[model samples]
Target: MVEAQHKKELERQLWNIANTLRGNMSADEFRDYILGFIFYKYLSERMEQYADDLLKPDNLTYRQLTTDQQTILDDIKQESVDYLGYFLLPNELFEVLAEKGKNGEFILDDLGEVLRHIEQSTMGSASEDDFNGLFSDIDLTSNRLGKNPNERNQIISKVFEHLNEIQFLLDDTEIDVLGDAYEYLIGQFASGAGKKAGEFYTPPMVSKLLAKLVTAGKTRLRDVYDPTCGSGSLLLRVAKEVGVDNVGYFYGQEKNPSTYNLARMNMILHGVHYRSFDIQQDDTLERPAHSAKRMEAVVANPPFSANWSAAEQFKTDDRFSDYGKLAPSSKADFAFVQHMLSHLADDGTMAVVLPHGVLFRGAAEGHIRRYLLETKNWLDAVIGLPTNIFYGTSIPTCVLVFKKQRPQADNVLFIDASQHFTKASNQNYLQDDDVERIFNAYTARQNHDKYAYVASLNEIADNDYNLNIPRYVDTFEEEEQIDLNAVASQIQQLDKDMIDIDKTIADFCAELNIKAPF
Candidate 1:
């Protein structure tokens, strides 16, 4: 209970800071600034802790050391770069800047310089790529912040002042307080981002389901990959399922530049060492970054039915070559699937979220589906998801799990979890029970009335390679039979009662010597 309250308080504080920029900029722009400031503070706190530990032997503190002690400062900087993959001078620390702001001093230039120095410190090092341009999205010179330089500095300082009040608890090993808070802020931003949210963030529940699906029956993974990694959430979710160290490495590719930076920051803030993750900014379909690497577990929530070049020449590319035809130029759902399949190891499991159209859409997609089921037999299971579960779109989606080596090659599991979700304000969400029921059905691969089915390969082929959920999982409800005879009896009884009442009325009229209109 204490931890829960702490988390809520931290989230409230961060969101309050985020709203400070609301009047001056858009959600996406302010999001970059607020998160960037938080990341800067996180780095500063980490550096302070590390320096304090190292200085303990010298009976001196980092803040006490002056530039006159050049040799000692150089030694510490060297050590910091080796351990933290970046270096920040005492003056460059976040606290110092906040203090200067409190003293009514200008700090915009210094803050920008410090951020640049952090990136530069990783130069010619193993973590260079990971730290490069990590703060590029936080544009300090943008007119959106203010019309003049002083206004910009004031805004930045106010953000720092608010962030300075929160303690990240870097020394506390038992809790990931800051990391959880960071994720909460990211989720909050995604909620308000609308359709743009789909570009970089996956709903946490969906991420959990995908992670659980891929990591099932396994305690460790050689590596995991996401072809269209968005903020690396799905990749990170896989790590949480098992011990983080159990996953040998993390690999992902995102096309968006700003989201690419966020993914890197998220990794570092989550305590993932820079050396353990490789995130690239490039089109995963057109220019695969980790093409040579085979992933033991892969997951993705690619854009639904996004357009791609689908050039004819891609037919010969290794990722889509064997399919004999490219996915439609207007819809690239199958293209992402094929890309992920190419990197899946022989013993790998991959789960990807795609539109329902991929299940039954004909032409090139149908050919690809038939090839996966009949020719290659890599398709393993299909799980239908609820509609409006995502941030922006309301279309229903499905998760497709594939494996190169299947225990039962002749059967494919189908689970219709569409009806099992709780309706929240403006959206549907999968409760824990809902997720578990689907997972249990997936693992058992048995028939369940109106929920799950295990269809034979022959059955799928008979249906002409349509993997639509309704065809396999019967969720139809039959209406109860009506009782016509009982209804007729009740009608006749009512009519008899009305006739007796009319006769009684006629007798009363005769006693009164008045004519009855009946």
Candidate 2:
């Protein structure tokens, strides 16, 4: 519990640091600088540790090695690059740069060169792709840093100094102290980012539901994936549900370059090694990054009501081919659904967060919804979430669970959790009990009052395959019985009082030489 408290304090401190530098800049803009600084600090600490271990047996400190010790230093660089995937010269380490900027002179140019060298050093190595462009977002020379190089260097060095003072304690415990803090900071930024937050983050509570739903009966996951993996948080949450050593691979794609870099960093920060996860940068909908593989558990909270090309060329594309017509170009909810379903393994289960429109919208969406229920029979359950539960959007969303093969093959579970959330000042949240009840309803596959229902395929067909929540869950509240006789008596009394008031008004108006007021 002490460790947990320490972690929470660390998270709070990091968030305070984030707000300190945020100034008046946009959350997205300031996020890159702060997170980049944190990553730099992480790399620097790891490098220092590596150097300390290497020099311990040699009776010479890595920091004390002379510039003339070229052969020995070169060997150390070769080995460190192989192990850490990037190299930082003793002079180029973050603290050294910070100290230079603080006491000596402007160091923006040197720092930029050092960051470039870190990326360049990985060339011709297995980790090249991973390290390349990792620091691309940290533009030290940008006007946003400051008007002049000196001012820029001052702020950058101050940030570095502040970060250096923190006891990251990465090695103090197996749990990722710094990584958890990073996630907390991400959550903080997401809260303020509003609609833009949806681009790169899935709220932690929503992530929990998806993770739990996908790993329900499993002891170990062979693999887990999120085609639209923002920061890789949702994918990582799956491991918490089960011992994840057996999770053989992690697969995901992000459309934004910055988020792609963050996902990779997030994976490494959580002690997920470079080789175990394959995160690519590209549009997942158009490109379908992992076409060659099918994952055991897939989860995604794609952008709600996002638009897509739905290019005619994709008519032949296997993901949407079976559905006959592509989801309309305007609404891409089902397009993401179709993409995730295609990548699902035969024995795997997939849970995705989608806008409620996908439930009852007409035209192509209705057709696609019909096909899923009537043709492929892939959808297993639809769970409605409370409104304003997502980071930005206020419209209610739902989780749609699909399986290549399902334990309950004949019926689809529908849960109306929209009214079950606790209302907060800014947003509605699902409490612990709320989450458990929803999970219990799903796992038990049992019916409940005003909360859950199981609908047969025939019943769904009778409704023309409209899987809307109301048709199944019946959230309609009955009206209270009205007392007509009491209402009539009250109305008669009111009429008599009105007549008496009119007579008095006429007498007053006649005396005052004015017409009676109506």
Candidate 3:
């Protein structure tokens, strides 16, 4: 409980700093700035701690080093690059900048240089790919920050001062809380980013569900992957399902440069070592940074019905060649499925969230659906979700679970959970109970009236391979078995009461010397 309170306070303090200092910038815009600064603060503290540990044998602390200690600093720099993947001088640490800002000194130029130095520190190192352009989204010269340079400096300095007031206690084991705080900020920013949120963030509940589905029955994973990694939330979520050490590595690809930077920060912030994650910045479908790699678990929440090139050249591509058809260029839902499936290890499990249309949409999508059932029989389960749970779109969606070597090879589990969510003023959400219920139903794999059903392969094929949730899990309710006799009795009573009310009005009209026209 104390830990929970600390986390709550940390998130509140960080969010307040973000909002109070952002002026009129959009949520996503300020998101880039605030998160960037917070990341810098985290790195500074980590560097100091690691350096202190290295100096312990000499009975010294990092802050005790003097300018004359060049040899010591050089030794520290080489080791830091190998272990922490970056280096910072005592003069360039986040604490020094915050102290300068607090002392009413201009540090914008210094701050920019420090951020650049951080990027350059990893040059030619194994971590270069992870650190390159990590700070590109933080454009210090943008006018959106303030009317002039001095004003920009003042606002940023204040942000630093406020952030410095909070101690993340990085040395504590709850360092995970710091990572959680970062995710909290991302989720908070996503709440206001509207439809654009889908581009970089998936709702926490959905990410958890997908993670659980993919990592089911496995204590450890060889590796996990997410092609549409976004801020790398889903990939990290998968690791949390099992202990982090249990997962060997993380592989992901994303297209948005700004969000790509955020993903790398998120991975490092979450304690995922640089050597453990290979996040590439590019279109997953077109480039597929990890095309030659296969993973033991795969998860994705690709853009709903997004458009893709669907070039004829892709038909012969290894990922798509076997399908005999491509998801239409207009709706790439099935296209993403085939891409993920291509990366699934023979014994791997894959779970993806997609629009409901993928279930019943005809044409190329229909052909692909048939091939999965008739040819591969890889689809394992279909679970419906409530609409409006997503930040951007209100369309209802479904989770499709696939396994190449399924023990239950004869049937598929269908769960209709569309109505199981808590409705808020602007959005509906899944309570823990709701997520657990769906997961339980998924594991049980039995028929429950109006909720879940296990349909045979023959039954699915008889319906022309349509996997729509409603087709198998019937949730139709007979309208409360309306009692006509009771309704008629109430109407009759209302008629009598109306007559009496009319008589009373007539009497009042007569007393006022007005005509009772009735």
Candidate 4:
């Protein structure tokens, strides 16, 4: 309970800072600035801690080191670069900037320079790709912050001053205070971002469900990959399912440059080393970043029904060539599925969240579904989810789980969990119980009345390859039969009582010496 309270307090503080920086910008616009500042502060704290640890043996503090000591400074710089993948001078640290801002000093120029130096420090290093252009979205000189330079500086200074008051608890070894707070801020931003939220964030419960589904029966994974990585939350959730050292590597690709930077920052803030993750900014389908690599576990919550270049040339691409048809240019649902399948290892399992239309949509989608079921036999399970659970759309969604090597290739498990969800103010959410029930049903792989079903390949073929949940899972509740006899008897008694009362009224009229009109 105390931990929960601390988390809530931290989240409240961070969100308050975000509001202070919101100014006149949209949630999406201000989101970039707030998260970027938080990330910068996190990096500063981490660097200070690491430097202090290294300097403890010398009985000299990192902040007190004189630049005139060329030998010692050079040695510390080399070690920091090798270990931390970047070097920050004492003056460039976040605390120094915050203090300068608090002291009514001009910090815009120095802040911009420090950010640039951070990027330049990784030049020609093994970690260059991970840190390159990571801060490109932070436009310090943009007029959007204010009408003029001074106004902009003042706004930024206020934000820095507010953030300086919150303690990130970086010294705590047991709890991931800053990481949790970062996730909370991301979620808070996503909640207000509307439809654009789908581009960079996945609902936390959905991420958890997918992580649990893919990591079933395994304590460790060779690696995990997400083609549409977003902010890398899904990838990090997969890491949390097992021991931190168990997962070998993390790989992902995002098309949006700004979101790609967020993903890299998210990974680093979660304490993942630079060499352990390979995140790239590019179109995953067209120019596949990790084309040659196969992952043991693959998960994605890609944009629903997104448009893509389904040119004639793509028909020959390896990812789609085997399907005998390219996913329609108008809808790229199956296109993402095929790409993930191609990158799946021989013993891998993949789970993806897609629109319900993918199940029963005819023409190209039907053809792809048939191929996956009849030819490849990779379709393993289909779980239906409630509508309005996502930040943007209210349409009901489903999770499609596929495995390259299945023990029961002749059958597919279908779960209708669409009815089991808690309603929030504006969105539906899957509680811990909801997620567990789905996972348990998935593991059992047996029929449950009005909840789950195991359909044979023959059954799916008979239905013309429509894998819609209602067809397999029978959730129709039989209406209660009306007792006509009892109702009629009660009506007769009521009629007799009314007649008696009328007679009594006539008797009373006669007693009162009044003539009855009847």
Candidate 5:
């Protein structure tokens, strides 16, 4: 408990530092700067540690190395860039910049150059794409940081110095202390970011449920993926569920450039090496970054009811060719489904969180639903979530699981978890037990009275392949009976009390000669 309290204090301290530098900037604007500085500090500490480990035999420190040690330093630079995917010079370290900024006597022009140098070093290497444009958002010349570049540098370096003071428990993999803290900061920022929160972050609880659902009966995963990777939290969660070492590769795509950078940084900060994850910055639907690969497990919480171009040209596209109709541009929920389904391996499974509208909404969505059920038989389960489980949206959502092949080919399980979650300040969250219950029902194929049911293809067809939750798992909680006689008696007693109060008021008004108050 003491340790838990300490960790909470650490998180609070980091949050304070983040908000301290924010000042008049909006949370989103300040978030990019603060998170960028923190990433820089993380890289610096990691580089320092790497250099320290390499010099152990020589009893030399990375900070103590001389610039004239050309041969030895070059060898170290080659090794460090290959291993860490980037390297920082002794003078370019985050601590050095922060100390110089606090002294109020140094310019950070060198610091900006160092940041660019890190990206340039990755060029012509396997890591070039990963590091390219990663620091584009942290513009030292932006007036948002300050009116002048010197002031901007001072603020950034100050933020770096403050970040350096906080301990990010990198060595303690037993706890994931830093990763958890980073996620907490991301969530904190997202709360104030309103609808924009949906762009990059999944509320951790929902990520957990999706992870567990996808990894259900599997102890090892060769690879995991998210088409709309966001900050890559869902991919990392899958790694945690079935030990990180067991995952061979992490693949993801993000349409937003800022979020794409965030996903790559998040993967690195969590100790997932550059070689282990492939994140692309582009529209997943249009470009389909990982089109050639088939993942072992997949999970995603894509933007709900998001719009897409749904151009007529995509009709011949392999992903939507089978659907017989294109998902309307107004709603792309089915488009994501089709895309994810296209990427699922013959033996793999995928679980996606989407709004409830996809289940019963007609037209293009209905046509796609029928094709999936009657043609592919890939629809596995539908799990309804409690309302407001996400940050911005309040409407209830549902998780749809798909498998290229299923052991139970004749039926699809539906669990109504819309009533199961712990309510927080502004959102609902799935507790551990809530997650377990849903997973157990899904795996056990349980037939609870109204909480869960496995509907046959014939039943689904009878309902015109609607796949709506209530059509299968009836969660219509009945209203309690009211005793009309007792209600009438209470109403009569209340009427007498009101009459007495009126008379008392009239008497008081007459005594005061105030024309008898009504």
Candidate 6:
């Protein structure tokens, strides 16, 4: 419990550091720089700690080692590069740079070069792809920091001072204090970043739900994937549900370069080795990064109703070729589903968050929905979520669970969890109980009057394959009968009381020698 409190305090302090750059630029711009700096700090601290542990027997710290001892330094560099996937010199450590900045030494240049060296250290190594361009978003010369270089240096130094004071405890043996705090800071940025947040951040509760759904009844997953990975929070959440060691590998793709970088940092910060995760930058639908292998569990919270080319050439693509119709160019909700579906292993369970329209929308989407329900019989469940649960949009959304193989292929489960959420600020969120109830009902595959229902394939066919939640779960409430006679009698008595009160007021006004006020 004390650790829990300390974690919260750490998260608070990390978020406070953002204030130093809050007004210098837009939230999106500042978020990139702040998060990049935090990533750098994490990397630096890890490097120094690892090197110190290796040098302990010699009664020498990495910081105190002499420059002439090239042989020892070279051995340490090889080991660090092999184990940590990067190398950092003692002079390039985070504490060294923070002290330099505190002493009013211009560090904007050295800081930039240090970040570059961290990335360059991984060259000719397996982690090169993972660490390459990781720090590309941090531009020290951006005029937005200030009108001149000194102003920019001063503000950056202030930020470094703020971050240097915190003890991240980068250890993962016990509670993941720094990792959870990192997640909290990312959420804070996502919430304030507006629509852009949707591009990279899925609300934690929502990610938790998706993670639980996909990982249910599984002790280990050979591989987990997210096509529109964003900040890779959803992918990490899945690892949390399944033990990290139990998860074989993490795979994801992001279209935004900056968000792609964040995903890599998030993975490393969570203590996932560079070899354990493969995060690529590119549009998943157009150029899938991980198309060759089928994932053991697939989860994604894709952009709602996002536009895509939907060109004729895509019909021949393997991911979409199986589906008879391409999703309309205007809305690619089902397109993403098809892309993920194509990569889902036959034994895997897939869950995705999509807007409600996919449930009943006709035309091309209807054709794709019909294929999944009727022809393939892969549609396992449809769970409706509350509105305003996402960062940007307030539209009602639902989770679609699918499986290539199912024990009970004759029916589909439906859960209406829209009303079972707590109101907080401007958003509504599901409590832990709410999520468990949904997961339990899904696992039980039982009928719940107003919460869950198991519908036969025929029943779904009767409704023309519309997986809308309301069609299965009946949440309609009946209003009480009105007492018109009692109400009318009360009104009559109130009329007499009004007359008495008016007469009393008139008498008082007359006694005061003033006309009675109506």
- Candidate 4 global TM-score: 0.95
Give the TM-scores of the predictions, in the order they appear.
Answer: 0.95, 0.90, 0.95, 0.95, 0.91, 0.95
Q: Put down candidate 6 lDDT per residue, 143-183, tens digits, no spaces.
A: 98988999999999999988999856545552367788888
Off by over 4 Å in 3: 482-518
Candidate 4 residue pairs in backbone clash? none
lDDT of 4 by residue, 1-518 (tens): 76777878888988998898887877888888989888888878777777888999989877887778778777877887788888888888888999898888889999989988888988998888988998888988888898888888888899999888876744664236677788888898899889999999999999999999999999999999999999999999998887556899999999999899999999988888898999999999888999899999999999999999998998888999888988899899999999999999999999999999999999988999999999999999999999999998999999999999999898999999999999979999999999999999999999999999999999999999998899999989989998999999999999999899889989999999998666
What digit string (tens of lDDT, one per residue) describes model 5 on residues 203-300?
88788888988888889988998999988888999998988778899999999988898888888888888999999989988788888888888888
Q: Show the colliding residue pairs in model 3.
A: none
Between prediction 1 and prediction 5, the one with superior lDDT is 1
lDDT of 2 by residue, 10-92 (tens): 88777777776766678988888888878777788777778878988888777787779988889889988888888888888
TM-score of 2: 0.90
Question: C-alpha displacement of 430 in model 4, angstroms?
Answer: 0.6
lDDT of 6: 0.91
Q: Tell me which residue pairs clash in candidate 6.
A: none
Q: Which consecutive 10 residues in model 5 have the weakest lDDT in total?
A: 167-176
Error of 1 at 210 (Å): 0.3
* lDDT of every model, 2 decimals: 0.90, 0.85, 0.93, 0.90, 0.85, 0.91
